[model samples]
Target: MRLVKTEKTGRSVHWPTIAALAFLVPVLLTALGDAKGAEPEHRPLMSFEYDPSSEVDVELVLAVDISQSMDTDEQEVQRAGYIAALTSEEFLNAVQYGPTGRIAVIYMEWGGVDEHFLVADWTVIKDAATARIFAGQIAEAPLRQVQRTSITSALTKSVSLVNENAYQGLRRVIDISGDGPNNQGGSVTKVRDHLVSAGITINGLPLMMKTSTNTWQAMLNLDHYYEDCVIGGPGSFAIPVKSKDGFADAIRMKLVMEIAGLTFDRPSFHPVADRRPVRCDLFD
Candidate 1:
C-alpha cells in the first residue's frame, strides 16, 4: 500500500486503493508488462576494475523530471535550459579549470516508478565542442511525459548508470530537477542516504513556478522539501526556480557550481539519522 502525507501535520496515513479497482486494473497490468526484465537484479555501486586512464574531475548525472505535471511548454523550456547550460561559457570555464580539465556526464529523464530514459550517455566534456555535441543529443530527443513522480527510482537508476559507466572521478554527483514531491515509489531519503554513503553528492533544482493542485502535480515548500529530503552529501544544495525565465540561468549556475566544486552559501541538507524535518516517505 502507498502512504500519503497529510498537508497539515506531516503525519503519514495509509490508504487502500481497492475501491478504485476499475481504474487501477489496466495500470497494474501495464506496470507489470513494463517491468519485465527491465533492470538487473543486482548492481554494484562501483566497478572493482578501476582504470587510471578513465579518471576525470567529476561524474555528473543529470536526472530531469518529465512527469505529466510538467506541461509541454514547460518541458520545452526545461529542455532548452539544459541545452543552454551545457554550452554556456560559464560551464565551459568551470570544466577548463577543473583538476583534470574534463568531466563525464549523462542526461536522463524520470517520471513514474522504475521509468527513466537516458537521453545522453556518458560523454567527457573537456571543451566547447564536446559540450555542444552532448547538448545537441539532448536537443534532438523527442520530449516525453510519463505518469507519477518517482525521484527514488530515478536516483536508483542513476547509481546503476554510474556503476556501468567506464569512468572514475574525484566527485560523483546526481543533479535531479523536479516540480513535485516523491509520490509513486519507495522512500526517497533511504536511497539518498545510500548514495551519500557511497560518496555521491546530490543537488536539486526544485521548480516552484506553479502551485500544487493535487498530490501528484506539486507541493508547497518544494524547496524546503528538496533541502530536508532530496539533496545530500557534501556541498549539496537546492536551487528553486520561481519563474520560467530563470530556468536557463539557474541551470547554468548549477552546472558551473557542480563542475567547479563551488560551495553554496546555503545550509547543507545532509540527512541526520534521528532528525528529519521532512518526511521523505510522505507519498500520495
Candidate 2:
C-alpha cells in the first residue's frame, strides 16, 4: 500500500509567500557506455590544469523531483537515467564540442517547498575521466525522497547553485525533471518568469507516466503544463517522457541538446526545438 507523505518534519516553509526567493551544455561523444550507480569506480585519474577560475561552455543545474509521488522504483529509474546520460560517450562528446571543451554542473533533488537536497556539488566535466567521477559521485550517494511538489523551490535553488558556482559560462541552464504539478509551493509561473527575465534559460523533462493517483489531484497533460509554466527564456525547451522505457533516452536526448546549445537546424540525432514562449499564468 502506498502511504501519503509530507516533506516537513514540522511545518513546511513556503518561499513564494515570502516574496523573496533565490535563483540560478554539451556535447556528444556518442559512446553508449554502461551505466553505474551512485558509487565511485576505482580508476586512474588524469592530471590537467586544475584552475578554479575557468570559462565553461555551459553551467547547468539539474533539478530533479523526489516527492512522495515519485515512488522508489520511479526514483531509481530517474537516478539511473541521469547516471547513464552523464556517463555516455555522446554526453562526453558534447562536452568536448563546446568552445571551451568543458562545463560546470551540479545536481539537486527537490520535493516540498522546504525540501531541496544537493546531491552533487559543482564539478567540471571536460573529459571522460572527470565525467565518470561525476557520475560515480552521484551513484555512491544515498537516494532521498521527500513529500509534496514545489517546482518553485527547485527553480529557486537551481538559480542559487549556478550563480554561486566556481566557473563562468557562455550559457546558463536549469534542467528540471518532474512528474507532477506544483501543489505545495509558491506559484510556479511567478518564479519561472522571474528567473527567465534574469537571463537564465530553463528546460524541462516532464514525466508523463500513468499513475492511479486521484484524478482531481493528478495533472492532466503534464507536458503542456511544463511547456507553458515551468520552462522559459532564450533557447528554452522541454521533452516529455511518456513511458518507463523511454526515460533514459529522454534524459540523454535532453542533455545532448542542452550541451550542444542547438537553437535551430539540429542534427538528425537531436530533437527539434520548440518555439513556444512560456507564460507565468499557465497552471491557473
Clashes of 2: 22
**Residue pairs with clashing backbones, model 1:** none
lDDT (C-alpha) at residue 251 in model 1: 95
RMSD each, Å: 25.1, 28.6
Runs in model 2 lying further than 4 Å from the true structure: 1-52, 211-219, 264-284
Candidate 2 residue lDDT tens string, 101-177: 99999998899887888888899999989998988888888988887888988898889888877788999999999
Tens-digit lDDT track for model 1 on 139-167? 99999999899999999999899988999
lDDT comparing candidate 1 with the true structure: 0.89
Model 1, C-alpha of 209: deviation from truth (Å): 1.2
